[model samples]
Target: EPEVTQTPSHQVTQMGQEVILRCVPISNHLYFYWYRQILGQKVEFLVSFYNNEISEKSEIFDDQFSVERPDGSNFTLKIRSTKLEDSAMYFCANRLRLATDTQYFGPGTRLTVL
Candidate 1:
């Protein structure tokens, strides 16, 4: 089966710096979402995108964070200013609008903010 892929499997960045994480899709999907899991914490929803715009976003997705689909293929999440709490494994998930409503996730990009 096809899947989503994230780049820079591991990333280390200093606090107050900017970082851009990318997600690429290898198969067809209707809805895309971004999620993060802090150290030892539950997977949290960050944002969801559809029709090339943000459909919904959680409180954690503040001004410091932004999402976009540049080049009409890959999705990207930009953190304008990183903080220590920003460190987590960022995952890219998508849904095929099937009957079961299952979500497929990427391997994830680990972001470590100092």
Candidate 2:
């Protein structure tokens, strides 16, 4: 079966540099989402995209963050400036629909800032 894949399973970055976390979602999936888990916190939704535009986004998706489908299969999330608080596991997920959707997640990109 096809699955979502994320790059650099673990990333260590400086506190002020930019980072682009990459993901390749399932080929036939229609909806894509970005979520982050801070060590002991709940998974927080960042953004959701479909049809090449943002469908929904949470407050966590601020000016420093952006996402794009750079190609047919690759989806990317860019953080303009990282912060120490940005350390977390960033997960990429995809599903077939918005409501009643069952999403599949990548192993996750662990971002470490120092």
Candidate 3:
């Protein structure tokens, strides 16, 4: 299993500011990547990146966020309009091979919106 590393391990911004968080996954694991945000006691799915397929998003995929894979191994999650409530530990994670496999997570990026 390969590990995913998220850069800038932590970020802070004023409410309404824009922030971009990055994820770097191993090449072979490029089949896809998904993101979820963990805040307090809840884990909510955010988005999924498919190499050549239509991306999937959750209800929380509201207008304030955007995602892009700048290259083969890196994925970026952008918060176009950060709110105080958007502050949380955002994780880039997904199951590698099968459903039975435990989901792997990147070093979560802590986003703090002031």
Model 1 ranges with Cα > 4 A deviation: 98-100
Q: On a 0 to 100 scale, what is the lDDT of residue 49 in model 3?
A: 69
**Which pairs clash in model 3?**
none
lDDT of 2 by residue, 8-93 (tens): 79999999999999999988888899999999999999999998889999998999999999887898999999999999999999
TM-score quality measure for candidate 2: 0.95
Over 31-74, each residue of candidate 3 has an lDDT whose tens digit, in order, gives 45555565656677787767645368888888888887776568
Candidate order by lDDT, decreasing, is 2, 1, 3
Judge candidate 1 against the unseen true structure and give its global Cα lDDT, from 0 to 1: 0.91
| lDDT of the candidates, in the order given | 0.91, 0.93, 0.76
Model 3 poorest 10 in a row by lDDT? 27-36
Number of clashing pairs per prediction, in order? 0, 0, 0
Locate the minimum summed-lDDT window of 10 residues in model 1. Answer: 94-103
